[model samples]
Target chain A: MTAQPTQTGKIIISVDAMGGDSGPGVVVAGIAKSAKKNPEVGFLLHGPKDVLSKLVSKRRVLDGRVVFRDCPDVVTMQDKPSQVVRSGKNTSMWSALESVRQGEAHGAVSCGNTGALMALSMMRLRKLPGVNRPAIAILWPSRNPQGFNVMLDVGADVRADAKDLLQFALMGASYARNGMELTRPRIGLLNVGTEEHKGRAELKEAHALITDFADQANFDFVGFVEGSDIPGDKADVIVTDGFTGNVAIKTGEGTASLIGDLLREAFKYSPLSRLASVLAITSLQRLKKRIDPRRVNGGVFLGLNGTVIKSHGGADATGVSAAIKLAFTLAKSGFAEKLAARVASTAELEQDAAQSALQTK
Target chain B: MTAQPTQTGKIIISVDAMGGDSGPGVVVAGIAKSAKKNPEVGFLLHGPKDVLSKLVSKRRVLDGRVVFRDCPDVVTMQDKPSQVVRSGKNTSMWSALESVRQGEAHGAVSCGNTGALMALSMMRLRKLPGVNRPAIAILWPSRNPQGFNVMLDVGADVRADAKDLLQFALMGASYARNGMELTRPRIGLLNVGTEEHKGRAELKEAHALITDFADQANFDFVGFVEGSDIPGDKADVIVTDGFTGNVAIKTGEGTASLIGDLLREAFKYSPLSRLASVLAITSLQRLKKRIDPRRVNGGVFLGLNGTVIKSHGGADATGVSAAIKLAFTLAKSGFAEKLAARVASTAELEQDAAQSALQTK
Candidate 1:
């Protein structure tokens, strides 16, 4: 590949332009809005040239910051992830990920098929050392000062063993350090109860594993956390299987929508009620923005070869653009490589600890 | 058993009055109200005589319809299930379950420790012929006229085999027939996706196993359902493991709370909006009442020799009262016997089907 435009110290984001429900139109619009404010950032659009050209022409101001590669094929949301990723190498999702793998872009963002992208990335880009399964780690709004907590394995691995969970904690910790700029993130396993022996066999095994690692000063591994702690933001990183994560996220989304409807009804009682509601509107709006899934639409698939961010398929232009910016920030953070190195070095600590225990016995 | 209190189609519900958050006060109150509405129902309150006497005195009007039996210890919410049930044979939860198992009561209700209740009931009542584990089946409110969909194995078997899921479906089908008054209930397996090849190994194996059963005329078993379908009431019975069920229910509860909060905020806009809200208040309240989980707090643990229902630990007086009424209704419903009979009758179908398939091959 020829030399692409560099943005000095700013992050370069390669986005799958022809992804999501509205395709490149929303993505391009979102990027246009984001690029105006973040001038230091650059975007590489991967999609059909004709579709993106029309959308780009409408937004004249986004000219310098954005560029495109005419990728013909687009991965549909319903497509079997493995089948398409293996055969359709020239698809927008694949092309965007290729940019990151080849070091042509700092990060890649897609609002298309998540499963396909993850499967493809894992097959193409080797997993991080000790990471049996790479996970989709995302930020969730919390009551904490950190704005939100990070959760992992949202849609990557359905059934995770002890080793997989350990890797999730590691990858999540790394993402928190880089993505959220946490110096040392507190990690916790999502369990039924807070007690040490309160979970299933896999969770129990995972707890012992993480605790053993924590003894070695590998990372800040906290104890088990309950389902209630997820929204409470008690831990910096919450690790769980993709099945549970998907359910939890969807439940949050559905519940948020339901509550919004309730609040609307509560304010319509009387004139005084309306006045009280008006007073609370700004504060409530701020809270809404905080918990809004759209605002935090982007998530990073950690333990992959490169920075691969997945945006919500239903995102509007604003959401798509925020995702692009988030991807750039994550890629430039240098957290992935740092995390890989940290994991590699600390792996021997576990082996050494096992040996010590045997000798002591 | 003291001449078996009115054996003429009268359902006798024996409740551990000391089981719930509100204790016998709420249970007695609920029984009083329900007895007034349905005189055919009889009640047996199992707990300490002194404690239950005070509660019964408060509802003295229904004294003729209810009787009190003395039992001592209570299973605390945090107790280890298996150990508690094994040791505490004369506890309130155990006595309540035993009353049903011994034919002294048709059904039993408890708002006490779920794990303890499940363990005690499973041990005391025993599983049906093919059922290795009993499942706690709950009714989740959906948008359909069927009122709600049933989710099973909510906390019975944490690590389930293919046989466990099929048995769950069979038990759930029987419940739908007896409790729901449907001749043949539509059953669906709770899974990530509908594809036969999707989900975990357990799900795949279960899916393949159920196909044989579904082919016969026992019940209409629909293939698979996602999380969204739980709220949609698309099927009569939805089957999943204890781990997934616990997470899904927690997510639903959390989501419902979030939605209730959102609706409270939505109507606080302006003066004209307040009047619009007034017009919509009745409809909204109607909607809230429909989705309120408190209405259906009691869940039956199916596939047991006796009928046992688990109420939420945090259930208040109204919620506790509902559980008592539900227990009484289910006792008369003859669900347990019908399920046992149905499974026994279908025993030959599987063997015959296998033989026929072999012959054809």
Candidate 2:
């Protein structure tokens, strides 16, 4: 592994090697692989130094791109978010996130428990100015050629009100613009229906708020959407409460896999089906690669002061490596800063609107 | 189609033929196939009389097992639940559900808009005693050889409190016991972690409430269970709020499909993988058939007065027919009455416990 220089000095991705289901072994391996591919990049692998060193010795590696930050403890999935952040001072996830916050690294990526990661990042780097609550922005494959669909507030706020939802929409819009390079991203609130009266009372209220903003702003707010509309390119950015958002993403992933399994089983039952599968195998593979959730390993936790990437807890080397690369891209794009600026101005605008309404009354 | 006699009186499954993505054509074909296997059953095919009659004419006879009820309008997937229920007076889905509610039919099934069905059911039949909200319960294949995993609150009660969750757990347990014939079914509350304090504050509180009731004479209440544990046979019944439950189920479905597709592609890419796929194909199909969501399409909306099953909105004929079968089973088994009695007693017991605790304090 060799260090590769980015135009902006150096692109360093701090890896929480001790995080995720497989621990530092896969994370370390992924970083090793990623480092070898990108010569100008460097990694600050935060974990137990001795263990990582032992693991690294078993594999082939040059040196400069790899380094270790000693973190004595690791955050378990079962631990409370506060406990993991406050009590586990020497945890790998915490240290890696801290490295990015303190500007020692350009960005950080963790395939750990999402709850703990969100809490620790908030407590360390903190939320950006005018951001009520940071959101977990995930890129899901839409039925369009434009890469993927970005949804936010996946596991950030459980009991979200109208205001929280509005903030989520704004944050997601900024991420789409800055990270995915989409201008005036069409934002849709994932509800039971597209009508104003379709969703819960909170959603209706949120719709009223965001619609007002969209009337004035550059962003395209496309009313409301349902669970089925997620796969379609109805909107580039989808926003919802963490609970619904999390379930929607998971459901889509689960259903897609289930259907694929069904198709495979059907194909195997007869010679004719098998012949058809053989013919369509290339196109099928391409579609699978495109829709694979593992390919989009890291989800940006939007509205934070610094870059906080949440990788899949069950990620393998390939997935974790993709997350590292994603974090590098997000950091370079300055998505966090863009979000902070937008949110700050939006909050001011909302306040002015409220004031005017009150004075007129 | 012919109606035959059973010990529990002649039960009819009224299916809305003009529902789902593929329409009544697939539904009629599926029902025809199912009816051939079970001649003792009866069906009331509700939709546009002309369209349904034309489709039915193409299918083989089931010895008078099939009938028809006319409905004028069809509800689209995008229609709001409330609006559809209110205005769709003569819709295929509405008429079928009404037949069940009015006791003209024992059960009804539709591959219609889910929100519309839920709204219509709640509006007509109303909630059961001691149950604030109704839950849609689906059976997923478990590692246990006995039956499938009973998951409740898939899309009912989005803003559920701890009390609401407790009600759902009890309802799910009762349904599992009566419908699935699992006595003393172990109930697990779905959370992010297995630990008591892992999830949101509400979940933590709900865990305490459930644990407190575990030692009582009701169903065996297990502690917290994670998303991954649901697939395993850790608990017979799993309960969560509608938002999380729906997502988890969807995620499970999608992820499963994704894995199968990946395997299919891999097998096609090489000779060795193809051989392995060939060897395991039969066993895999059997397993998949057992776990298919479409096969378990009829999810009972427990905590509602009378029997109302929510078939998946995107359900095909097989799924709709299965839902119809599920509804009949519930009706004949007298599950609604038994659950109502049990829940009434449980409510009384809870009130008594609260009174005693206050005296002690």
Candidate 3:
């Protein structure tokens, strides 16, 4: 374990520079971009020192800001989560997470295998005091004034019981506060319908538990929200089991991409539409930027002992930078500690609520 | 129940002309549109006689095709499924379904509450022999050359066990063969991942059961598919529990609408872009037609004794016409009888497979 570095008015993010689809080049380039914009941010870059040094030396913005750790092992996309946890101690992903675990860095970011990263994170950071399972929270582009809504348990595991859902609500609310700067974010339980009697029995039980703990958790419980409400302003945080959340997120993305492709094809259908496309190129670029998945590229592992931002495996420089920026923001806000304390304080109340709700059922 | 109308050359469709958000006017106009194009189709219009008679009398296309059945009660959107089953006998929705049950009409279409419509259909028409649950299958615009993929169990029930999923596959395959004119539809069980070990326990059980029964059911079982594959060319039919299917459908719709609005806003951002919009309007309309929900407005109730198409509650004249056209197509092809036979014969195999899969687990 690395020694904890004293705070010196700067935030240090541990970056796993290997395992991403694009390799170490994009990760170093992304960190350089973030460093240029945020003078208060520094990086503990993890990978083979020789390779990372070559990339970092080419980028002037990275000068005096990157501390390289020599880690030759890489966790491939094919590696199972369990396999990685057992024999991946020397890998860059593990080393980067170690920096956060040891308190040497404020947080960790990886653009690697999601399952493996999540496994290593849970093994290394462990679950927060009472969290039965950790969740991965992502910021989805939405109709909210803030432009995004937080959805959790996107794929940490397939199932979430009533108690687990209550924990997700608290964690998601906390993330919304720190990540999106929302105060007392409105929370909604994701369901097939907004009606109380609708959805699976577990969802109904979770709804009651969340409602019972809403005031104590310092968030407004907006009750049930449907899939269409994911982008609507009806809820600030949508909570569900990983299975539904994962499917909904992917479905939304697939639909957006499909529509986007059709739009492009439509624009080039005829010579007249082609000329119009040129004239509207600038405005179209603006719209593209607004909905680009890269702008909200990171999925934060919540309910763990430390914060870990999982970038998309195929993220380019801009996407990686967005993830790094998120990690920096969370680190600067001391989000991990705040989240742990919040979960710890409410553990007892959540359990009581879950018990009563189940007993009544 | 009314006596079964003697089979004439024209196929008869029972239309619930009340209970839709737009009321009887849209229903009459929709039937008129369908009748204008298809002289072989006729309607058994169910609603209050004075209202429906006045509306139908004004439509020249429906002059000889419409037969009115007076049903004074309307099934409001707020009616619960159980409540509707208990005492909604005189409602237009019930009357419309009754026409199908009594064999007076080949099929039925309604734009009333989904839960209520499904309940009445299940109660009056009953489930096909050996079917544990009936599923609602919808056509989703996709990249397939056929331009659509069938997804089942979208909201008939919130949960589905292994055996129920097998039933959905069989029913969905029957629908694709009749409704979409596919010879042998490719069936994929919806899951979070393509891996066999992924998703919920029931999904794993379903994967095995579907695989075991695919040969006898006459559909190619493509195994597990992710949400992103819903619009992809990987499968012609995607089967899942109603809860997940419902959420994915709404999420897809929500995302497409959000992007469409953003594109419109972008095109109007500047005078240059506004000019571009005018030039692109024709192409845009073409694109809209390709993905219009109104074009595919009906959800077919599968595994029921009689086919019932549930149109969108808020469907306008065009949407209603699409639903009516779908009902006519299914009726003409004798889809209801085929689905019933398919489910009946395969039910024993499905149950045996489910038992084996469970015992192995």
| Superposed Cα deviation of residue A56, candidate 1 (Å) | 1.0
lDDT of 3 by residue, B265-358 (tens): 9998999999999999999999999999999999999888787999998999899999989988887787777777777777777778878877
Model 1, chain B only, scores a TM-score of: 0.91
lDDT of each: 0.74, 0.74, 0.89
Candidate 2 per-residue lDDT, tens place, B23-123, comes to 88888877887777665567778899998888888786654666778888898877878788779888988887777676666666777777788888888
For the second chain, the TM-scores of the candidates in order are 0.91, 0.91, 0.96
Candidate 3 clashing pairs?
A: none
Worst 10 residues of 1 chain B by lDDT: B1-10
Cα TM-score of candidate 2: 0.81
Over A24-121, each residue of candidate 3 has an lDDT whose tens digit, in order, gives 99999889889888998888999999999999999998878888889989999888888899999899999999888888898899999999999999
Question: Over the full model, what C-alpha lDDT does candidate 1 score relative to the true structure?
Answer: 0.74
lDDT of 1 at B165: 84
TM-score winner, 1 or 3? 3
Winner on DockQ between 1 and 2 is 1
Candidate 3 Cα errors over 4 Å, as ranges: A1-8, A355-361, B1-7, B355-361
- Give the share of true interchain contacts found in each model: 0.18, 0.14, 0.76
